[model samples]
Each structure stands twice: as C-alpha cells, then as structure tokens.
Target: MDLTVLSYVIYLFISIVLTVWVARTLSRAGRVFLAQVFPGSEHLAEAVNHLLVVGFYLVNLGFVSLYLKSGATTETARQVFEGLSVKEGVVLLVLGGMHLGNVFVLNKLRSNSRRDFAVIPPIPPTGFLPEVEA
Candidate 1:
C-alpha cells in the first residue's frame, strides 16, 4: 500500500476513535450534569446522555466518511512539507474542531445543569387559621 493511502487511513481511524472516546466520556460524566439539568428525573437524564452520544457519532462519522482525500503524488522533502493542501487540511481540521466543540458544548450543558439544580431552601408548612364565631 502507498504511504499516502496509509496516512489517510490512519488519520481517519484516529479521528473516529478520538471522537467516539470523547463522546462516551462526556456522556458518562454527563449523567451528573444531566441530573442537574432535568433535576427530578434520573431516568430522563440517562436517556438524554445516550441520545446525545448516538447523535454525535452519527453526525461525525457521516462527515468523516464523506470527506475527500487529497490527490496522491510523489515529491521531495520540501514539496512534501509544502504539499499540505488547503482543502484536505481544512477538512481534517474541521473534523477535529467539531469533535472538540461537541465536547465543550456538552460540558457546558452539564455544568449549567448542575448549577441550575444545586439546592434549595426548605418550604415551611402553615397550620390552619382559627375561624371567628359569628
């Protein structure tokens, strides 16, 4: 196999693996945050975590599979170094960036959930008032 093909394959593999790993980690940590977000329903929070991971994988993998590889060619050290084309690089960068962004957004959501549900003061119960005789 050619080096370029190998490189592309490695890149794709690593990108997918990284994305999935991050997604799973976020989902696991998200349970706590999700609890905060939804407050009263642990089941709902767990479901949301699962759904987020599923959606994240579906979107990211679809994009990665559809990504176009750069043209293959031979070149000297300088050419090879300078040969990093804008299109391919941009696509890979975007892929990585999207994964990173997903993690960031999910983390923020989790934190917000936690903050939104921290704690509350207890409510006081009122006894019945005495009725006046007519």
Candidate 2:
C-alpha cells in the first residue's frame, strides 16, 4: 500500500475513535450539569445530551473526512508519521475547542437559571397610616 494511503487510514481511524470516546465521556458526565441547568427536567437533560452527542459525531466526523487529504506527498515513513502527527494534533485541538465552547455555553445557562430562581428579601411596610376622624 502507498504510504499516503496508509497515513490516511491511520488518521481516520484515530480521529474517529477519539471523537467517539470524547463524546461518550461528555454525555455521561455532562448529564448532572445539564440536569442542574434545567432543574426539574431530567428528561429534557437526557434528550439534550443525546442530541449533543449526535451533533458532535456529525460535526467532528465531517471535519475528519474533509481534512483527510494530505497536502504533501508521503513517500517515506518519517513523512507518514509527520502527516499523522499534524492531522491528529489539529483534531485534538478542534475537539478541545468544541468542548470548551460547550462548557462555556452551559455554564452561562446555569448561571442564568440560578439567577432566575434566586430569592430576594421583601421590604417591610413603611410607617403609620393616618387615623380617621369620628
């Protein structure tokens, strides 16, 4: 097999495996945070989590497939490793960025939800009403 073809295969395999692992990890752990963000709606949280995983797969896999092409010829072993490293590195960075974006948005939602449900003290009624004349 051509080294370039080998590199493409390796890159696709690693990218897909990493994406699925990260998505599953996030879905499992994020449920609690989502539940808190959408208090009294565990079902909604679960639904949102499932949707998120599906979207994640669609997006990351699309990116992986689109990014599969190597810019330079890969005739040598060193070139194959270099290509794989660069490709995988970019994939990792993209994954990290997506994770951070998700967390940032969810944290904002959680904060807003907390603020909406915050308790405020009521003010005491002010001084005396006028007496009525007989």
What is the TM-score of each predicted model, taking all chains together?
0.58, 0.88
Backbone clashes, candidate 1: 0
Local distance difference test, candidate 2? 0.89
Indicate which candidate wins on TM-score. 2
Model 1 segments more than 4 A misplaced: 72-134
Each prediction's Cα lDDT score? Answer: 0.67, 0.89
Tens-digit per-residue lDDT, 1-134, candidate 1: 65555555655766677667767776777677677677788888889888878887887777667663556563444433344344346555765676677667767887876776677878886887789999
- The residue-level lDDT of candidate 1 at 15 comes to 61
RMSD for each model, in Å, please? Answer: 6.2, 3.7
